[model samples]
Target: MNDLETRQLRYFVAVAEELHFGRAAERLGMAQPPLSRAIRDLERQLGVVLLRRTTREVTLTPAGEVLLRDARTALDAISAAGRRARHAGEPTPRLRLALKPDIDGGLLPRILDAYAGQEAALPVDLVLGRFGEQAQAVRDGRADAALLLAPFDDHGLDSEPLVTEPFLIALAATDPLAARPSLRLADLAGLSLPDGSSADQGPASGWHDRAGAHDDAATASIAQDASDLPEIFRRVELGSVVCFFPASLTRRYPRPELAYRPVDDLAPATLAVAWPQTSRSTAVAAFVLAATTVAAATQPQKRETPQTAVT
Candidate 1:
């Protein structure tokens, strides 16, 4: 209808594109019932049937086919107009990004400093949160981008590796093994690890055996398991089990009460920069470039020998 707005046409086009009312409703941020009503209203206003729907499938009718092309053209033109207007925005828009708790140390700090020095007009803001929630925020457009440990595979998203960091060991300053500059995994034969989270969810091949109780300090641990969250941190708190973590993370969010050292043979952890493929903001690209540069400059982990011991 001539009286109908471009917004309704846009809504109709989205439903037409997806051909699924539920998905369209979700995208529209409305309930299915209201979406169905809106579509019916649109059809009534146009005085033409635009969709062919049934319980098994939904398809565009001949009328919908005609409307689809026209709607897309109109929407694209409007979007282009908006982008042109947005081009006048500040060249460096402050970028809001999400990050893993493990990155509070070296990697993020270096990136922020690099961005500040290179793009003085744009400042970088890194927000720390759970990985799953952060990834979702990027997809939903709540965040400009995010930094996450890898294994993320999601549609409509893009990711790039930023760093590959190795694991480190942490203990009280009084622990006997702390005196070594760096120790082989085999050297921890009868020693215990204290951090629970890294011990379980992380690789434990050389440090733990995975056969002991959560609180069994005398049994000794050789593997880190993520499956049991509670038990892992508990033992670490009591100073009975030594915990392992990505070296970068440990440096960022350091435990003043604990001393950390590197495990020579453990594999490094990968950190990735992720953003929605739909983003066209120039700031996002600038941030990514700066971040990748820091990744490139990142030093390969060195073998650590401890200088203290658990008291």
Candidate 2:
């Protein structure tokens, strides 16, 4: 309704997410009675039953489910608007870009240099995040653009592909498979892989998407969880788990104990520049153009299919 306030939506979202009035109240830094009254009043004004409650528990009605989804989008948009307004008011507003370290396919420096020469370029602000965080940062207006890998969630964003490189399987050098010239995806069917869903893992870990082996039951059963690249390398060296990584990683993080071999049938990883679909900033446009141009000049036009090379 036009009469609905952002505060009411915020209150509703907290309760809907927590599913407990007391917990939501505590989260919102308020007491239970007033929170309960506010929800009741909101339902009356909307002429809809949003929640179903009992002494034992709380649940969302069908309408409430729909509201919860839409409410989050609305709240994010409101927050973005406020952020943008404040940023615009600054005397020298910088263009915020989000990315994960070592995931840009080694094109970041060139891209930055290229953008610096653009007429509309502004000072770039780098916002580094872990895996699965760049897209949301763009969506919520925290960053103007991002450099991300492919096979990521691209909803509510527009992106341009920069470079695509084949995948390599990282395993203990002592493992039998490491001696092979090249391995097929089927060779890893029964091996344990890293769980990308681990909170500590970032996209740069090389196994964030699990690529071609995601559907394999054995691969799905996580062998170990790691927080950073060195930890992942340690697990691989110890034969705790095998991982799929973009070919670029071999050059960046070559290790003596770990061997990298190409997977013949595995899918390749693409690096792209992404920004909010609704973005109109000239700085964002210039940055995207600069990134794509630098990629075209510096990256190979066609990557050779995986062969027996091991690093």
Candidate 3:
């Protein structure tokens, strides 16, 4: 069997993501030639060509595609293992949770209280991340668990359903569509959706992408350039764009400038608690148990309210 080092996988992932040797090398703080040589060595050892290259561009071969996915998982596991080990040696270990800001809809305070009531509860650290970043936080060991929105890549994580709720469209109060009682996906045709660079794709892939193809408005989306939520809101206020959000947001962050309309065609949002698949931490286990117990008592039904968002 060919021996592959973690360093090799790291180099391969950098190159694969950048699709350019120079850019990948720059990102890794290494020279292009050494990075190139290392990838060649990796391919030789594995007995497969991972990348196809020409003068103009480099692309992944079939084997390369498989390796990229596996390599990401392996790299994440290694990183998480190291972080978890270091945390274990601390004077007083703590559990970190990650989640989006202001999306928890008033369930966080109670969950914290309940978890603290447990005999084995550890000090909980909150890691607030942008949307769709919860998965990465758990994978990287920055968090023991996360409150993540569904339709995210759960490849190396274990999750439990905490809350499920329908979606709503956020439009400027002054916009004509704001007066409508309810709207369907067809109503959004040809309108540009708000854009955000820091926003994770969340569940906007596969079926989501296909839905856009059926209507010009469905496919009309702004370029991925908005830096933050406030900026996206600014765009909405200007009547230039619109965005979809969980119904809970209407209660969590109601704005006089914004109007929320029920969207029947979009899939309901599912908030979940997710942890690294390989985690064996007692504190993490206890927290997950505490969270589930609290959720069952509170919601006890689908698409209900008072769901907490824990990170």
lDDT of 1 by residue, 107-182 (tens): 7777777777764326656665533456655654446788866555445578888777777776655677778877
RMSD of 1: 14.2
Better of 2 and 3 by lDDT: 2
In order, how many clashes per candidate? 39, 1, 4
Off by over 4 Å in 3: 196-227, 300-311
Give the number of the best model, judged by lDDT. 2
lDDT of 2 at 301: 64
Model 2 clash pairs are 131-203
lDDT per residue as tens, model 3, 1-311: 66788999999999998889998898899999999999999988989999999999999999999999999999998998898889889999898999876666446777788889887789999998656677888998888999877877799999998778877778899988889998877777656665321112222632222222222232234332332567767887888777777777777778899998887667788778899888777778888887777777777556758869899
Off by over 4 Å in 2: 14-41, 49-62, 189-192, 196-227, 299-311
Shift in Å, residue 220, candidate 3: 19
Off by over 4 Å in 1: 1-93, 101-105, 117-123, 171-235, 240-242, 252-265, 299-311
Query: For residues 1-311, what per-residue lDDT tens digits would candidate 2 score against the true structure?
Result: 55889999999999998898987898799999999999999999989999999999999999999999888888888888888888888899999998877788988899999999999999999988655678777877888899988867786789999999987888899999999988886677567656633222323434564432333345444422332667778888998778777788788998889899887766678889999888899999999999999999976569779899789
Report how far residue 46 has shifted in candidate 2, in Å: 2.8
What overall lDDT, based on C-alpha atoms, would model 3 receive against the true structure?
Answer: 0.77
lDDT of every predicted structure (CA atoms): 0.65, 0.81, 0.77
Compared to the true structure, candidate 3 yields what TM-score? 0.84
